[model samples]
Target: MFDSRHIQTFAEVVRTGSYAATARDLGYTQPAISQQMKALERAAGTPLFVRAGRGLRLTDAGQVLARHATGILSTIATAHGQLKAITRLESGRVRVCAFPAANATLLPATVARVAAAHPGTRVELLEEEPPDSLRALREGRCDLALAFSTGHGGEATDADGDSDSDSEGGLIELPLLDDPLMVLLPAGHALAGSSRVELGELERERWIAGCRHCRGHFVAACAEAGFAPDIAFATDENLAVQELVAAGAGIALVPGMTLPLLRHTGLVARPLAPAVGRRVSAFVLEGHETAPVTALLLRTLSEAAADMERAASGSPRPEA
Candidate 1:
């Protein structure tokens, strides 16, 4: 078998194009570098280098081996990095999936905290809705999932009827916060000055709906109010919904987690009467919940959520 050390040395030699330079760079004696090259060539069953004037050149076999060796060494370095991260808890990669709103508002500060505290750790964010985030967590495609429930009885379920249990095979859910859905209205609309609005009041108003589950919540709420909404536009994007409301196209129901991302100036938000909302939670594989990196990230997320809550309540931000 070809030793990884020899393959690394060979790649370094190709990079430097001089045995002495490779030896200096790798902290190996010139003779040791030569010996490693010979060993690599023998393992390849062909000569890998030749004399060209006062310098050395790669033979056809050497060129082929060098190409493969570069990739092999790079993979080895990556493996080493990952192993170091796992063993030390000072560095690692955490894959996170969240809906677009949370990705915009909640994830940024949490990820920034993680990056600052553990500079070696890498956090990757993926935008996905609740069902998809949970699926990604269960399939081992993601280490963390920031998912939400519409709180309108439309939560995703398996055969067991457990909304947040391991029926999906060892998945764990950590409830983070309840993000209440608030109605968005144009600033000049009839009910814009109210602190809260009844669904019945907006029955005839043009409406902007969200995803299928969100629309389901709106429809159910409207039905409870004895009317069906005249949904004029359907979009899941928080900004788009806000813009539509700002432009007087229609009103919408937006989740509290998306509050910080609202940039439209001509819109007003009011809570629903009787309190309709969504529950945002973090999901992970059962065994990974206690992992140091995952735990740290979870704490940061909770802190960020708290900050968002304070901001939403018009409270002054706490000093750092």
Candidate 2:
């Protein structure tokens, strides 16, 4: 029945040898400190201190409480250290899910960074699209999900709203970055020569759309055209989309992250006019134990993103 606050106050007063000093050090008023001490003593059903000159010294009962409290403090400190090691990466498994675009830029770099820093740690990567990534995190399928969107970036939410969907309740969403959406078109395409193109310009062009469930490609890029894309094709294969563009079959709206990974030399990359960007974020369940690893991954990806941004500005990305 010993409260942590009471024990902490008792220890502080004992260490400082005066309630006034304890109050000063802890930012508590003297009266409040005294009240807590009295409550602690009452809870223990014993006297815990005795007046010694202008200070109070431990009574026999107080000594017992101090001894127990010291152990409690030590236990708490050890637990904290354990969690720190997990963050600093002493050892553990980190499971993450990412959309294709994020995996292209963010995830690989993150994995490499985590691997080098925490060699004892293991990472499992699951590739899922935007909203589905959120679902995976809520269902406990993974520790973290790299969720994404057209503009607001990705956020992890507890999907536990109704005992029905993939998203579970008690979830935590963490924002990562807002990635600029770029144009992927065949080389020498009129739109590619320009630095950027607005979504509206392509309203009449044949569009390569993502599958129905993975609406990111269509919604983020083509939706701004103010008309649904004339879906000449629907496929998750970004490579295929680029190939089709190169073949003059159609053009596609591709994430800027994919520019560095595209190997099709016949294709050209351009930024979206008016500078549209998608938001990317990581999702985790509430009270997750792998917070350290997830944090490391998120941090590394951010660093990589900054580096990419530096290269992307005023410079065309070399074809992969």
Candidate 3:
């Protein structure tokens, strides 16, 4: 039979690199630590440790088992914390990333909910835009990523007019909502006088948008209006693009989800004349299903987006 004590001792020995060091730290004799390792190796039905460089090292199988065991330990630790939090109303931490503009709406509401539930769930929030957020997840820099996608950002496959949502590799993208791209007009630009602005009508107008990652969707949306946008400026910073528009520099496409955050009185947000918008989506690397909390966060985010849309459409949440 396997014991939690056996797992704990095996982890300690792997961490310390020597039976004697592990014994010293755990206050157990070297023989006891060795026996525990042997017991674990036998139960797992594979050799775990190998002698190397005057100390013990993990075999390939051992390293794989170690990683799984580490996660198992982490889950136990997290459950304990959550239980204590439920009792004392104190929680731990959840690391999340999002664009600066999204913080205005989603973050505030999400913070309110998590804060009320655990009262102690510390949220380590980071500011990152799409593709960057995707990269961060791939590099293990963050646990969950709040991002968006389009034809050109990352490896996206759109056949003719159909979406190959399941065709992508490297990242698993969960589309949350379709936030149409709204055209931001300069305070007193010619088209600003119109109740609605059409891209084809502004054949001579200039455009500002996010760099490569964001430019593709904005460019495609403008194309739907029957003209390529004149590239007067391009930037990844949302505020910078808005400020430039406010300065009468150029018109740009801003996602609907970020409308509330773009309170730049200097600019007016009008739906695209051709009707285009960004597809707001969440992203995570493949094979992360083992993380229960990560799944919970994804669920919470998806629910929030759905709630936002339901409120916008004046619909009620589905019956439980």
* Alpha-carbon TM-score of each model against the true structure: 0.68, 0.61, 0.60
lDDT of 1 by residue, 1-320 (tens): 88998887888898988899998998989999999898888888999999888678999999888779877876677456434434433347788888888888899999998888889888988887768777666655667888776645667322123455665456677777878889999999989899899888887899999988678877887888899899999998788888888888989988877777778888888999978876788876666667888898888998988888888788988888
Candidate 2 accuracy as TM-score: 0.61
Model 1 residue pairs with clashes: none
Ranking by TM-score: 1, 2, 3
For all predictions, the C-alpha RMSD in Å is: 11.1, 16.5, 8.7
**Sequence-dependent TM-score of model 3:** 0.60
Candidate 3: tens digits of C-alpha lDDT, residues 1-320: 66778888888888889999999999999998889988888998999999998799899889988898887776566455434323321234456777765666676776766667656556667878665765555555555567655544342222111332334534566777777767788777766767667667766788887767567776666666678788989887778988999988888877777776776888887765656655666665455533555565667777788877776557998987
For model 2, what is the C-alpha lDDT against the true structure?
A: 0.70
Q: Which stretches of candidate 1 lie over 4 Å from their true place?
A: 1-91, 156-164, 316-320
Q: Give the lDDT of residue 274 in candidate 1.
A: 78
Q: For model 2, how does the per-residue alpha-carbon lDDT over 149-194 read when each residue is reduced to its tens digit?
A: 4432222222322232233354555555566767788888877788
The lDDT for every candidate, in the order shown, is 0.80, 0.70, 0.69
Best by TM-score: 1
Q: Look at candidate 3 and give me any clashing residue pairs.
A: 180-277, 181-276, 181-277
Name the lDDT value of residue 126 in candidate 3: 81
